[model samples]
Target: MNHQEVGKYWNENAQTWTTLARAGYDVYRDHLNTPAFFEILPDIQGLKGLDIGCGEGHNTRLLAQKGAFITAIDISEVFIQQAKETETQHPLHIHYQITSAAELPFAENTFDFATAFMSLMDIPETGKVLSEACRVLKKSGFLQFSIAHPCFDTPHRKNLRNAQGKTYAIEVGDYFTNQNGDISEWGFSNLPESMHNLPKFRIPRFTRTLSEWLNIIIQAGFVIEQLHEPRPSNEVVKQYPSLQDSQVIAYFLHIRCRKS
Candidate 1:
């Protein structure tokens, strides 16, 4: 499938996704990935930033709260509408638009920085998305993104648990197999049991190897700055026991790169 087809899935999922995400059902993002991504982020006070695949603008609002003027975009119209509704009530310095990450609607050197929160892996054209990000960033501008770890969160993954029912290791295969827009159906594991009847999300999967991601970034004129595998803190794990599995094997990867 192409980006448009992938976007249709997201659009269909927008309302449920926005509702659950806002209700804090996305535990990995809330307690692990976003925290780690922001920890390594450079200060963005007074900077102009673009949020690629901003979803309901949760992370975009975080950036804006940190004093950046943010332009946030997503391919799903309903997602953008939800984001705009929040912006209207909260009044952050955010501009919301329904736009595709692979084709940014801006001139070259238009932003000081850009960010994608657990979004890069959802989009079909990774290379084109990176190229657009690089093109729109000013000299020395950086782009940060997070995704399911290509090494561990493969098309085939299984968890090996100890006698205590705690994850001790992860079993993964198909590391070399690349997938483009394969449909994956699942619901947020952290959601309350009361929501068990909720329909699962149909997300398009776009998988690439670690080396392939690095090469794509390099080809898009980006110099690798840092790569992070986020592990939940002991305190966080205590609060969210399900996240303890992250300590055994990283479930997510964060990358920061500068336009060369």
Candidate 2:
């Protein structure tokens, strides 16, 4: 799908995304991706930052609370509204806008750093978005992002098990092929009753191979700084039992890059 179609898909699913965010990014992000990301993040005290694809501004608010003057943007109007409402509830120095990542609306070299947390895979034009990120950052500025591991989270994924039915390995297909559309169910069984009753949810996503992701950032004038493949901790598994197998299978990849 094209950028416009991708935006429309997100707009249609914004309410569900908002509900998921409100339910907390704790299980998915906090327990899984955040630790690896923060390890490479420099102190943001007294810095200007941009949060591309900042869903409901949860992570953007964290940036503000950490002392970064944040400018957060999302393509979905409903998501932007929800973010603004969050800002009103608890005042912060955050400027929120409804804008696409492919075309950022900011002066060149305006931000010290930028971030896209688990958002790149959802965007159709990854190269364009990365270029826009580079255009907005000062020389030597950094961008930290996390996404579902393209290799493991392929268009077709399956678990390989033995006679005992214990997952030994994961099987993936179409690893090198770029693919998009509503490939997976978005709604979870454990969601709140109000959320469960909502219509069937299937969000659009675009997938690129690992090399494609790296090449895009390099072409956008970035040098790779750090790469992390995070697995849920044993403690986390105790709290969220379903994530036990995640400890063995890589679920997410985090990258830190600096503008050259």
Candidate 3:
């Protein structure tokens, strides 16, 4: 139930996760999360960036595409290997390493920016990870990351649906409970019926209150710049009906902070 164990779970999930995610099974990410994260992001052309928890280098490749020199890391060896394989084929010049976010291999002020797509909340040592992110960012550099909304996506959550099987509200509980390293099992909801038999991913849950996240970011030497609760646009909802539940409540949170 520690970070090492969490890494092992991710290692087990690496191949399937990468395959499904690349195949568009991660609907929320492709439809809402990643697009929202990029909307507020500053131009990183010619900058040196570090992507912590860069599973299979999906978002890292996006960063590289924006003209940044990227070094991406993930604790899972398989994840890094898959990312490296992608790099070999595409020749993006990205550096992929098997490294924990809580213990980065780089020196202080080494990167102009840093990012953790949806991986921070999965990390058991959130504070240490943020501290390491701060340590590696240059002065005025920013760290922009996204996570499941703490208020709605608690240790216990379910979608309340109407008679037509449309989600109307979210039922969430155990918000005050400490959930460090608790195991949660679920597969991507967007997978085709033929792939319904795929094994569920065993992911470690590390739930924290919104205040706790803010305090940790401040304690890590970051000044809060922007906080966003991303909801799918009308067009997105029409395209991906499953995301309509997000209109009832924010499903994801994005934060951008500057090294102070």
- Per-model CA lDDT versus the true structure: 0.92, 0.83, 0.92
Candidates 2 and 3, the one with greater TM-score:
3
User: Against the true structure, what is each candidate's TM-score?
Assistant: 0.98, 0.92, 0.98
Candidate with the larger lDDT of 1 and 2: 1
Tens-digit per-residue lDDT, 1-260, candidate 3: 66788999999999999999998888988889999999999999999999989999988999999999999999999999999998998999899999889889899999999999999999888888999999999999999999988898787788899999888888999998869887889999888899999999998888998998899999999999999999898889999998998889998999999999
lDDT of 1 by residue, 1-260 (tens): 77788889999999999999989999888989898999999999999999999999999999999999999999999999999999899999699999899888999999999999988899888899999999999999999999899898688988899899899889999989987777889999987798999999999888899999899999999999999998888999999998999999888889999998
TM-score of predicted structure 2:
0.92
Instruction: List model 2 lDDT by residue over 1-260, tens digit each.
Output: 77767777778888877776577634667666776677667899999999998988878888898899999999889889989998998999699999999989898999999999888888888888999999999999999999998778888888777787556788889888777665556564346675557776667868889998899889989999998888877888788765665676888998999999
Query: Candidate 1, residue 79: CA error in Å?
Result: 0.4
Once fitted onto the true fold, the runs of candidate 1 whose alpha carbons sit more than 4 angstroms away are: none
Clashing pairs in 3: none
Cand. 1 Cα-lDDT: 0.92
Clashes of each: 0, 0, 0
